[model samples]
Target: MSRKEKTWWWVAGIAILVYCLFPIAWIVSVSFKPPADLNSGGFLPDNATFDNYRTILTGNAKDLFRPALRNSFGICLIATAISCLLSMFAAYAIARLDFPGKKLILSTALVVAIFPVISIVTPLFNVWRQIGLYDTWLGLIIPYLSLTLPISIWTMSAFFREIPWEMEQAAQVDGATTWQAFRKVIVPLAAPGVFTTAIIAFFIAWNDFVYGISLTSTDAARPVPAALGLFSGASQFEDPTGAIAAAAVIVTIPVVVLVLLFQRRIVAGLTNGAVKG
Candidate 1:
């Protein structure tokens, strides 16, 4: 509130902004530089072009790995949709309704969330192979649901608890059923939380490499992260760094845009019920 404090705050804000943007600035800068200059010690590109993007995009079908991008997009989007929907209802019930052993169930979900994902990978891989789901998109998705589901439930439950029970009671008094109140009234007020949870779930699935790499074998089922590993370095396929940088840029752009667009909702989701209404 004082002049000195305000000046210090402004200086701190600029410092944080530069720190966060520095990596992005470097990535974009690298994306333009020639292959020869990729390792060169330079902050800015001396010879920049779109050739990296063009080369990767127009490369041969066998080596380009474009199909992996499609796979990642389709799988991540679908998994996020399902995970968000399931989390909303679970959160609603836990927040708004009383059930036998409700606290126990919530406790179990939290415990499961704390368990290391790597610990289950072996058994999961075995089960997937036994059930004939191994090396398939669905196989990867099933595990991904686990990754997104617990957090989604936790986040959504916190959000729903912020809404007063009186709102739902009022809706019921006006002839709305419980489901109707949830669908029409509660969901609308919780739209920001839902959007925020969906984005989180999407990114969880999108950025996943462990499951994608272990579960899927072929290009058709493998996601972009796995494909990136496969495409890098080749005696026959020289000049892969440029392609790698280009792919990194392409994969990163959408997430950055989405985060910026829905940042308001994300902040609301994180802070919605911090203070009692």
Candidate 2:
């Protein structure tokens, strides 16, 4: 590339990075600021302190934040596990089997995935209440599956299609059952895809807010996103801005760590067979 082109690319890359990271940076900065410095109109806090973190960690908001954190972790993890398991099987069938309704199945998943969450929440809320699922962990997990499963199936199908068919055929010929070959051979080879799908599924369920808030009236099954919405200051007059920012930063930590740790697997899963070998 020409030096001018390289310079322009560098400029564009830096601009995009700054645009994306600026909000996170601002949140981190605000998290360290005390209540008094929240309105100081500065990018960096003049009196940086740990008070906001403490507030959410061990102070007045502990009861609200900690339980919600647990709920978010548990629900997302369970949802991701179920989504990955079910998607792996369904995707394998879609990719490998010459079954009827293959196109129809994929199309249905696509349609369901694109369906608006808001449009369904009202009837879902009534249904859950009637079925004794409202304000429960299962309630959130079920809707989360609706969000995570279709995408998981789509991504894993792409990965499965890329895997060499001969590998599974050889395994089956060597006296292994089809299910055994799939479980012992195909699944391990798709580890990167599985990890990628799990992270994506977890993120979808973790960041969910509408169902979290709409279905649950209390913290019993309320997730971090919903709990963060209900954060209150000492009194009605006080704003929970710093506490909210701190909680946001804390909630963001796991996502950042997951991306940093598995970024290579994620990239590989995404680009596994984009180009012909």
Candidate 3:
């Protein structure tokens, strides 16, 4: 490419980056803006303070951030853990073990993944309510399993396929049983892929807004996304734009931190699995 072309490419790339990041930057920036200048129609505020954050952190209100944060974290953590354990073993089985209907099983996984979970939310909600699981973390966790399991199976299956059979054969030669070989050999080898899938599952459960909003009304079970919607209620605060932005920033920090912490493993797992055999 010519110098002009290279310059244009760099400019285009920076513009795209800025466009993507601008909304996120604005959320964080407005979180620090004084309520007086909250929606002052400017990117930067005249006076900035941590009052919005303090309100979210220490303010005494029916729907506060701490409990919502705790609830979201707990639900996401439990859902991710359950999904990861089941997916890891399921992926191993699907990739390595021979079965009468392996192809049928994989095809079913694909079909289930393509279906939207929203369609069944009402029925699930009704069932949970009937069984007294509604508005509870267990209720949320059950639905989340359906959300993450298919993707985890597919992604982890790809990683498992990349493992050479010779590794398992060697373990078997050393008197390791089938389960032992998988536990000691295959699992450690697929650690990066396992972590990557867990992160994906956690984020999916965390960002789920539809189920969180529809299934729970009380603050005790509602997550940050659901609770954030309360700021714009017709009967509540006149204009809570700043408070909403502040809450958004607070909710986003945990996800950003998780991504940064596991970025290396995630990238490596994806690359290794995606590369041609």
Candidate 4:
């Protein structure tokens, strides 16, 4: 490309990055803004402070925010773990085995993944309440598997497919049972893809709002996203925007840290799985 073209590309990329990051920056700014300056209508707070953070951490909103934060972490992690384990096995079967209805299984997972969450929430709501699962982490985790499993299976299956058959055959020749081969050799090789899928699954479960709100009635199972919506002002007449912003920033930090820590593995997994072997 010409110099001008390269420059334009750089400019365009930077612009898009800024555009995507602007909202996060705005929220961070709002989180630091004093309540008195929240409506001052500037990008940066005139008197930036950690008062909003303090509110959620130790002030009036602590009770609601802290429990919800714990719930989010617990539920998302459990859902991600279950989804990754199941999908890893399922995807391995799909990629390594030639079985009847394999296509059907994949198609069904895709369909479930794309199916609207709202349509099923009402039914889930009724069932959970009836089964005494309402307002519980398990209740949310179960539905979350529906959201995270399809993509996990598809993504992990691709990684499995990219792995050479010789590796498994070699293990078997050395007296490894099929299960042993899979556990000791195949699983370790697929670590990048597994990590990638786990992160994606965690993000999906963490971001879930419909199920969190519909199935859970109290702090017992409420996640950060749902609780953020129901946040009340420090006082009845005041706005909860600052506190909410602070909580949002706190919620986002973990996701940022995760991506930063795993970006290399994620990229390698994605690129390796992009094409079938």
Summarize candidate 4's per-residue lDDT along 80-145 as a digit string, tens digits: 999999999999999999999999999999999999999999988899889999999888889999
Lowest-sum lDDT 10-residue window in model 4: 268-277
Q: Which candidate is the best by lDDT?
A: 2
48-137 per-residue lDDT for model 1 (tens digits): 888777766775433546888889999999899999999999999899889898889788888877888888888998999999999887
Ordered from best to worst lDDT, the candidate numbers read 2, 4, 3, 1
> How well is each residue in 1-277 modelled by candidate 3, as lDDT tens digits?
9999999999999999999999999888888887678658889878888877777777633346778889999999999999999999889999998989988877888888788878998998899889998889988898888888889999899999999999999999999999899999999999999989999999889999988988887877888888888765223554667778888987888989998999999888878856564
Ranking by TM-score: 2, 4, 3, 1
- For model 2, what is the C-alpha lDDT against the true structure? 0.94
lDDT of each: 0.85, 0.94, 0.86, 0.93
lDDT of candidate 2 over 55-98, digit per residue (tens) = 99999999999999999999999999999999999999999999
Q: How much is 210 displaced in model 2, in angstroms?
A: 0.4
Off by over 4 Å in 3: 61-63, 232-237
TM-score of each model, in listed order: 0.92, 0.97, 0.93, 0.97
Regions more than 4 Å wrong, model 2: none
Stronger candidate by TM-score (3 vs 4): 4
Q: What is the lDDT of residue 231 in candidate 1?
A: 67
